[model samples]
Target: MANHKSAIKKIRSDERKRLRNRYQHKTARTHIKKLLTTKDKEEAQLLLKVVHGMIDKLTKKNIIHKNNAARKKSRLAKYVNKLVATA
Candidate 1:
């Protein structure tokens, strides 16, 4: 539907970016779920670090809101701490 060549190129580029963002978001969510289900304190701690990095990257890329990232990281940290406390 785009009549101009530039508009067509923009649409193509936007599609690619959208796919990339979707993939990253899905991957992050998968990791978060894995972390949430982990019973081992050591493993959970490792996953917490990795998940935090992924969340920070998403925030920096503007794929997710900063507050959303912060909330995720906070909850994850609390969960990991609770695991440690129990152990």
Candidate 2:
């Protein structure tokens, strides 16, 4: 569909970036799920750091919005804090 040489190149690069972004987003979500499911406070605490870092990276890259990242981080921290309080 892209006729111009530059247009074709742009399409190719966009596809590559899309796949990479999807992978990173999925990885961050997996970490968040794992963190949410863990019963061990210690393990959850550690995973929270990794998840937060992943979220920050995504937000920095503009894959996710700043507010979206903040909301996710907030929910996770709240959940982890509740776990800490209960245990």
- Encode model 1's per-residue lDDT on 30-55: one tens digit a residue: 99999999988999999999999999
Q: Residues 1-87, candidate 2: write the lDDT tens digits.
A: 989999999999999999999999999999998998998788888899999999999999999999999999999998888885334
Query: How high is the CA lDDT of each candidate model?
Result: 0.95, 0.93
TM-score of each predicted structure versus truth: 0.95, 0.93
Best lDDT among the predictions, by candidate number: 1
Ten-residue region with minimum lDDT total, candidate 2:
78-87
- Record all residue pairs in model 1 with backbone atoms less than 3 Å apart, i.e. clashing: none
